[model samples]
Target chain A: MNGLSLTDLTWAVPLPVVIPLAAAGLALVLWRNARAQGVISVVALSLVLVTSVALLVAADDGPLVLDIGSWAAPVGIDLVADRLSTLMLTVSSAVTLCVLLYSLAQGLADNNAETPVAIFHPTYLVLTAGVANAFLTGDLFNLFVGFEMLLVASYVLITLGGTGERIRAGTIYIVVSLLSSMLFLLAVALVYAATGTVNMAQLAVRLQQIDPDVAFALQLLLLLAFGIKAAVFPLFAWLPDSYPTAPAPVTAVFAGLLTKVGVYAIIRTQTLLFPDGRADDLLMWVALATMLVGILGAVAQNDVKRMISFTLVSHIGYMVFGIALSTEAGLSAAIFYVAHHITVQTTLFLVVGLMERRGGSTSLDALGGLARIAPLLAVMFFLPAMNLAGIPPLSGFLGKAGLIQAGAEVGTPLAYTLVAGGIVTSLLTLYAIVKAWNKAFWQPAPEEPREVALPRGMVGSAAALVVAGVALTVVAGPLYDYTERAAATLRDREQYVTAVLPGGRGEGRSADVTDEARREGGTDRVEEGSDLEDVGPRGGEQPAPPEEETGSDEGTDEGGTP
Target chain B: MIDTSPSLALVVVAAALTAVGVYLLLERSLTRVLLGVIFLSNAVNVVLLVSGGRAGGAPIVDYTDEDSMSDPLPQALILTAIVITLGMTAFLLAMAYRSWQLNQHDEVQDDLEDRRVAQRAARDEAAYLSDDDGTTTLEQEAAEVHDETGDDGPPSSGPGTPPSSAPGSHAVPTPEGGDAR
Candidate 1:
């Protein structure tokens, strides 16, 4: 699209995942040198930011595909940098970088008392790598691997100090996460068994030919797995308990990135592999429930961190709402909301970290008169808090407006109910936030306040995120356009499928195996517009298109084996 | 075409593993929870094995004919999964040990907020009213939650008690009581 070939841009696709992984190894090796680890992580994430932005710009023209080690699609894992992924990647890298800077400042300010400095850098880098991997991977198995990488890193980060409360929270968090991972693994297994391959692009082409019932089962399994991870309604019990116990930076990043990765997976699988929208109504109800239930929990919380955690679960409903609509407009708004929420939510948590520092507690009753003491902290807290509440003229309002508009266009009774529920969720969010604001800032201090020097580094990083949230509003027009384009490409799955499997096959050396299978099976499917890539006779390891491809019978009869 | 159906034996074993795993999962002890996780992941691994179609010779280039060789992908996935599960197992064990060290028991504790809500519900009290009137003091709220070991009664209960004067200087309210479980 640009002067540079998409091939040239393709190299940037893997860099987002590879850079942090390589840096993680380096940081781990330099574990003794905290400063060195910090620098390595910073430089690595900055490079990821650069690469992701480049990919975001380039991907607007078309999806950028990278067959890992040149093994080709269906046969090997691939990384695709399409509009949706690159947009997510850019936003996530930005958020991670800011959170890293914030934590680095906290580490310096606390003199390394809060975070286990050596372990923190390496784990944080790995977490970023995992997020990048999840966003970029085009293979279902690799997606699971990406999820595991991030989840494991998170398990470590969440329980950093192994304190009593942290350990307790981490236990629930880890067990719930492990269960979800198992479910996801089971889903992957079933999807593979049903479709004969895990490469998403190939599965996109092949899954359509399978029995509808089996396909529906596979879809439900995937949704269940992702639902738990996303903290969707009914499966969100672990999140509020576990999230609040972590240190501020860890909580901020986890809140920002982890569930979104789950949302991202749901989006990819729903739109690409199963475009029929069979689960739309079910997802809609889940969305409504997540929103109302989550917000109600937030309203009932006495603690700031726990309140925010509940809000995080609640807001996930909004994204699910978009996905349920199964329309381009719905998808675009969901993407926009994701980007906005990451920045706003992370900023809120970081600001609350500052509050914890100044006020000496996260409890609403214990904290008072912060407006009189630290006006700067008050402003920092207020802006993102209101943004999170979706007040008008902010990016939150824009995203919500887009969703409401999209819902009206659908005009279904259920869609209208969700629209009403969404508005109610927004109002309740504002109520909870304002109540928090009054208690923390406006209420008279219960006692004479002592001066606690707010760390410049922490405040500065938090401020940067706040500004980034506002920047999203300033650039809402262009950002909305980008999301629209992303939604378009996502809805039209062919753009992604073709990019991954060019010439009706991946650009791998395995073409010979495919040719051999075609000859041996005596199927002239190569003449059928070359739409189907015959699963090679090598144990039917790849997917052969169902129904239309006659060669699959011979391929499978001879190749059926573990 | 592909004999995608799993064998009866594998299916039975997987089902049994899942049932046991789920049972263990519901146990209060962290070790049992870890075991549950291990069993459940193993069950999923077996399912992955089943997903590969049927057993055959090693899939290496020279060891077996291409058609006769097993689907190497699922096995590869299984290997990866096993390794990940192992790492998670180690982490969980360390966490369990830490829990044991901290509380001298590794039971998964109920959420503190849940305890508060339950207490409020038991009293037929409104959380909104308690929060609004400042009648239920922070100490009272903390004392009601007995997540860890050690028994103590509430310091003072009921309305119009002045809020703690040194709220900022107070330690995190450590409200310990006998195991609620």
Candidate 2:
């Protein structure tokens, strides 16, 4: 167990999950007291932010695995704190904290219909908890649980007031999410049957040893499961439909995290378990298709929310492109891209919400001349719009630059094609943003529209995100380095395997497990070993070489006999 | 596990559900479409469950017998899927009800199409009005002839008209300026 005790960190590892959950309970208890619920939510999210930062610092050097209740791996649930997981937690917490504040401001302003403000605080806390859990979970089953936790919460948030527009959008969102969950469940079963383990670490090792055909099928199934959640190419139809209908804060969070969670799962699976670039070529093709189709959809939309939704889908392609390259630089770029996209997308949605507030409707046809009426609101929209379009001195540009650089380094025709696809998507994204600006702000105000006024404190909430987005751009160098380090760690299976499995060494130690094999089936034995080692810290190893090793691992695993 | 080869039965059930779902989805009625989505989702869930093997074996593990455990992972996944589906179904129903209230209709028709038809009719009506000189005015003809001339004629007195002396008058001009006395 690395001679480190869970008590040593003063329960910091589990606090990220626990604090929000407890806060959710408290908020529910204080549901009748709006101010109290708001205060509780703020305090809880602040704690989460602090814990997430501490966890990041603690896990900076390597990964940290916590076996709940000190039970052995595979038997007890595990919460893993790796660079990737902690980074995700950190970003999610920050974005969510902003979103919570925004929602609180929105509720307090009393601009919305007679929905219960009290319910929002608790549900939002639950949603944050779910996101944290999903990012930190080592077990696949727990990942599903985390997804369901947030899905239920989101369903309520999406349909909060039972408003017609919200209901219309929320309905599609729920149905699509439910279907995705089903796909995920089906995938888990196949993976469990094929490898007899649902722990990600164990499955990674065991999956390598399964029959090639079975493994391939299982990989495809898992991809489909996560792909649907992430809104990848063929599976992204529900996103635009559902996202546009939710209230501003709800839409912002969903745009920022929901599909990204799916993308996060894809990244973890592709890098940790199935590192084979060949097997994931299909993903690359899908990435291109997703970018093209999503932008095309965005261009066709006249509604501000719907346009942003499509742009969200389009930007997802960049992350997929980074992951599909299956190189250190590419994966690192993908990580950076994920972080950048989360902030920028959320900020943009918030701005759209503001636009909807000030301009009566989100319909481009109905809105005009907002820039003249409210320049501050225009700034909010402009910054995020430019960031999303990948303009220079913005985090979006840095993220795209990283991906393009990685693609160029790979020097393959397919890689170049993806690079071009990314560029085109960016241009289209800019066009969509400009179109929105022209209709909602630059053009003259329409006659006979509702007199929409920007709500108090809404601008402040949006400004917080804009400031963060700008800060991300300013601090791109350090952030890129961090992502690169994390990606390197992810590429190296040896460090991860050794950390999880007791007596795990660099070489495959099958002979030692032969005895255990006689006691349990081969699948069961492998599963137990992996569960124990999945969350352990990486020992001494250089970061750069893991990239080459990952490539070789992919080649050998696919070509070598089982 | 059911003693029957559940794969065949599973396939039949999935197909039937899908057929019903597709039919419902194609219907103009939002309620039917929502039902179709539910059935379609359930069918997909069944497909996922069946894909993992259908032998009536418990997924729970007995330490004593290693091979006897059925695949519990799928069952766990199915539980979550069901919950998500239920939430989604509720949301959809809510939206259907809301849509009915807003438009007073259950059918999903494109707003753009409706706008286009309305616009075409408006244009045709304008053309018909132009043909009848009684409804057309000299100012309208003059403005149409010299669009760039910054002249829209005098504004009309409409109900709920803003007071002309309002502070924001310089900022915006009325659309009916040319028609008013």
Chain A alone, TM-score per model: 0.91, 0.88
Q: Which DockQ-derived CAPRI band holds candidate 2? A: incorrect
Ten contiguous residues minimizing lDDT sum, candidate 2 chain B: B160-169
Which candidate tops lDDT?
A: 1
CA shift of A318, model 2, Å = 0.6
Q: Model 2, range A1-562, lDDT digits (tens) per residue?
A: 2334442442577788899899999988876677888899899999999989888887886676666775434555678788898999999899999988888878777533424576677888888888888998888878988988888788888766554344545556665676566567656655654555677877777767655666677678778888888888899977877776567888899999988988998888888888765565788899999999999878766567778888999889999999999999999999999999999999999888777767766766667788888899999889989999999889899999999999999988988999999999999899888888877787777653465565667778789999999999988999999999999989997666554544442122222442343345445565544542321111001113434444344334323422
Candidate 1 local lDDT, A168-272, one digit each (tens): 778899999999999999989888876677889878977776666677888898999999999999999999998987889999999999999999999999999
Candidate 1 chain A: 10-residue stretch with minimal lDDT: A531-540
Alpha carbon lDDT at A226, candidate 2: 87
| Residue A236 CA displacement from its true place in model 2, Å | 2.1
DockQ of each: 0.25, 0.08
Residue pairs in collision within model 1: A562-B54
